[model samples]
Target: MEKNNNEKLESMDTFKKLITALDAKLDSIDSRLKQQQGRKGIVKYYRNEDLKRAFGLSSNTIVKYRLTGVLPFTKLGDIFLYEASKIDKILRDNEC
Candidate 1:
């Protein structure tokens, strides 16, 4: 009976260690997935005020740019959103 009790205790200790290691590995994988998502899965946006401050653009000029297809923006109700990637490409293409 004492030997059987010792075996049960050893098994429980091993099981607890295995569970702790599995939890650590799962946490590592979750952190890596979050890092990858931050790099590629997320779509960064710029607001109207962001453009105005970054490029010295007037609100009317931004409107004109959008209307004339010089700039592309997404309109959500009263808000405008510009994709950071598209804006970067536009600037790169137009850079002297």
Candidate 2:
């Protein structure tokens, strides 16, 4: 009876230790996933503000460019998004 009780207690302790180690590993993985998700990857598009700062253009000029089809854009509600590749191509084609 005494030996049986001792074995059961040892098994419980081992189980608890295993659970704690697993939990710590899971926490580490979760933290790494969060960090990776938080990082900004390659930017494929630009917003109005991005164009304004990068090219030193005003909002009015940006609007005119869109209206004249100088810069093709995608409008979502009120926000406009421009393809980075297209902008680069237009500039390269029009280079002096």
Candidate 3:
């Protein structure tokens, strides 16, 4: 009976360790999911020069569009930045 009790105790200890290891793996997976979700929401902006290159337009044309409100833009201090996705849509719409 004593030997049987010892065997049961050892089995319980092994089961508890396996459960702890699985919990740690789950936590790691959760953290990676959160990081991926965070990256999905991030917004990156491009400068006017980069936009001109991206849209295959001249610098002056880019300026005209900005001044005429043909393109949407954001000013961060002295730098102008455009949403890349919006620019892509505009280019697709205009076929240029």
Candidate 4:
């Protein structure tokens, strides 16, 4: 009877340890998933209209910046896309 009780207590302790380790692993996985989701949600490009709205500028102003090399852009066929972060920085620098 005494041996049986000791064995049961040992098993319970091992089970509790496993549960704690699994909980820590799950928390780590959740934090990694959140970081991945945040990366996925970041905008890679901005359309002309969207960029204009974001910067409170007109289409013509966008063109001027592109021509003057003040703003960098990427062309996808005939469509243009500006890096959203870079545009934000430019706007911040110009205080616009």
Predicted structure with the largest lDDT when compared to the true one: 1
Q: Model 4 segments beyond 4 Å from truth?
A: 1-33, 38-43
- Please report, in order, the local distance difference test score of every candidate based on alpha carbons: 0.95, 0.94, 0.87, 0.89
**1-96, model 3: which lDDT tens digit per residue?**
999999999999999999999999999999998998789677778898887676688888878999999889999898999987877777789884
TM-score per candidate, chains pooled: 0.62, 0.55, 0.54, 0.54
**Global fold similarity of model 1 (TM-score):** 0.62
Runs in model 1 lying further than 4 Å from the true structure: 1-38
Ranking by lDDT: 1, 2, 4, 3
Residues 1-96, candidate 2: write the lDDT tens digits: 999999999999999999999999999999999988787774589999999999999999999999999999998898999999889999999999
Candidate number with the higher TM-score (2 or 4)? 2
lDDT against true structure, model 4: 0.89
Model 4, range 1-96, lDDT digits (tens) per residue? 999999999999999999999999999999998998789567778889887777688989989989999989999999999987888888789883
lDDT (C-alpha) at residue 77 in model 3? 100
Each candidate's root-mean-square deviation in Å?
5.8, 7.8, 6.7, 6.6
Reference-based lDDT, residue 67, model 4? 99
TM-score, structure 3 vs. true: 0.54
Off by over 4 Å in 2: 1-43
